[model samples]
Target: MLGICVCLFAVFTHVLSQEAEEPVFYTCTEGYEYDRVREQCRDIDECALLDDACKGGMQCINHFGGYLCLPKSAVIYISKEGEQVPLPAVPAVPVVPAVPAVPPSQPQVPRSSGNQGVSLSSRTIRCAPGYTADEQNLCRDIDECATGRHTCGPEQTCYNTRGSYTCQCPPGYQKNGDHCVDRDECALTHYCMHRCVNTQGSYYCECNAGHKLASNNHSCVDVNECDVENPCQHHCYNLIGSFLCQCEQGYELAQDTVSCQDIDECSFSSYMCQYQCINSPGSYACECPEGYQLQGNRVCQDINECETGTHNCQDDEMCWNYYGGFRCYPRNPCEAPYAKTSENRCICRSQAECQGLPPSIVYKYMSIQADRTVPADIFQIQATNMYANTHNTFRIKAGNEAGEFFLRRSSNVSAMLVLTKPLSGPREYVIDLEMVTHHLTMNYRSSSLLRLTIIVGPYAF
Candidate 1:
């Protein structure tokens, strides 16, 4: 009996489980339907499926399962008899009327709910002074810009506010009433130092030819011409707005002032040279003639080949010094074996006739210091081969016979002369010395030294 009751209980539990899995169906209302997932009836939101169900002049407001239609009040007007009246219905032609503000003198009337049931008169409505009633009979700001009602020009912009609209200029512009004008940014600010150009909306700075804009974008600065490839052939200097070229020493700037030319130093009269001046590329050189050398780069001094041991003189000849050269001649040509003495002339083996020598050859060499009390030997006669068998006689005479010069023999072989007076100025004195060598072995005596002219003076402190 317990097993039978267990079987019956199992069957009853299965039937109850099946009924819980499959729910029953029910009829739904006009505005509600059943949802299979929830297994219940839910109200439908008619506002989402279709347009608003509000009639006449009303606004639709949605709720949990339904929507409410609220009536919108029309613009209220006061009658000529001071009685409140409803706004007239709009014509089929869609006419828009200007709604005026409710006057303070009129009595206020409450708005209608739109469900008059034909038992109530039209409801009163109102708006602010500048506000107008929209299609839903609600107060809204009039968009004069969108409706083409604003008096602003093309350059002006219209802005709508709570109850009215206004016109204003755009950025970088100015407004005067309904008109707009462009703003001059260049004149209104510290724009540029050089030049300012005004564009449509802004301004810019510009510089001249040899200038550049500074880092501040306002002022101008000079361009450094030296930094670029300048046309100058030498040194280049950059100025404030220009450039210049310069040359070094011994050079000059050309006509264009950009190229350098060599200066002809030889053209100047003050050149430090005695003989000749030669111009080089950029400098000059002092030159002398043949057989001469430059002294102190200015004076031309004779290159004494005899004293310098550069002459080709034979052992039997003597080198004589000249202005620019040296000459070699036999020593004492008068000492020939056939030399003789006549009444007043000397005869020698004639290779040439003997003429009086010039003053330079007669003196040979001479030098005297200023203000010397002692005697100074300026000339010495060389002894000849005839001196061994002859007795020499000497006589000296001064060109200026003022007792300025006196002669005496220091020894039998030489003579010594002294200047007794000091020279007052630069003056040359000539002296003649005649020496007669008596040939005791020969039959006659002849004077060999005739004129030995000496020059002195031209000395100073």
Candidate 2:
């Protein structure tokens, strides 16, 4: 088996050598003669086909056209003295020192200042993963941006990194695909006092008329017009965005909101006064006339000048008050021709003849109130002229047709006059009382007369 294997290897080696020496062309179309596969036209790999394609001391290397045979070593072998004949000498090649190799983990710069004896032809260097070697034998970062290799848009900015790059937009802009667009902040929200003005990278606020911007710069506040000036004649009231006028106490606001006018209370028919109504600035006053005073604020009452001692009546006359006026009434009545005495009493000269003719009665006037219905003591007379002892004899008569007054004698022999009923109606009556003495010495009777007046109502005074 070993001999057969050896024989097969020798045949394969011979075949590869013959194939290498003579040119072989695969059968294919003329334009596409060479193909990568062996089934078509292609270059023959002699080393692959036969492991020992080259002879001793020769190296086999395949090429596009054919194969190459190179000498593996060219050194001469000198035999020791007395050993044997020395081998043939090959051509000499100059020796050069090897340069230090830079590790693949780091990059290295070329050593330009070494000894002249040192050679750089055999130097080996490598760059780090993120760096590339330049012609100067130095590592440098790649600039993708300068080389037009960045993917940033026209409006974007490109930044070069170590072996990489970056793309971005400006501060107030947003990245939208290839564009660096301005952000519309105003469109996103209302950020102004009254109106929003959007600008490049900024925004502002504005206020309308009669308004002012607030501290926040995004809202508006009403401007108070009344605070700057007094617009009302009396008082000024401030409202939102406007002003109003108001009047003090008794006044009113005019049609114009800025003016105030006085109100005439007297002009209204509801003004209530007893007798006189007086108007003032914005109000009215109620007053009484000469002889009248206000009972309530709205009613009038007659003032009694006589009772208040405010009258001008004489000593012999009486003062009387009516609704709005006063009058003076005489106290007593007598015949006009009869002269009044010094005491203001009435006397007649015919009294002397009546005294001489019979026992005449002299009538004296008396005034009485109708409220005195119970028997009231009228007079106590002690006779002095003719019948001193006939005090018990008396006669009484009332001139009243209604018979309201009569006279009676008491236990002490005194005369009294009484009314039968309390006088209530508007009427006046008279009473006559006559007294006579039963014992007459000169054959003449003594007589006396009394007159009484029953008065009711105001005239009773």
Best by TM-score: 1
How do the residues 209-265 of candidate 2 rate in per-residue lDDT, one tens digit apiece?
A: 667778867678987867877777887777776667778888887787677677777
What is the Cα-based TM-score of model 2? Answer: 0.35
The local distance difference test score of model 1 is 0.53
Clash count, predicted structure 2: 1
Per-residue C-alpha lDDT of model 1 across residues 112-205, encoded as one tens digit per residue: 3343112233322245454565654344557777888777777777765434566767655666555777667678754677787776645578
- Computed on alpha carbons, the lDDT of every model, listed in order, comes to 0.53, 0.51
Which window of ten consecutive residues has the lowest lDDT sum in model 2?
A: 6-15
Query: For residue 289, what is the lDDT in candidate 2?
Result: 55
Off by over 4 Å in 1: 1-131, 135-143, 155-186, 197-202, 208-210, 238-244, 255-257, 295-301, 307-315, 335-461
Query: Considering only N, C-alpha and C atoms within 3 Å, which residue pairs clash in candidate 2?
Result: 35-41
TM-score of 1: 0.45
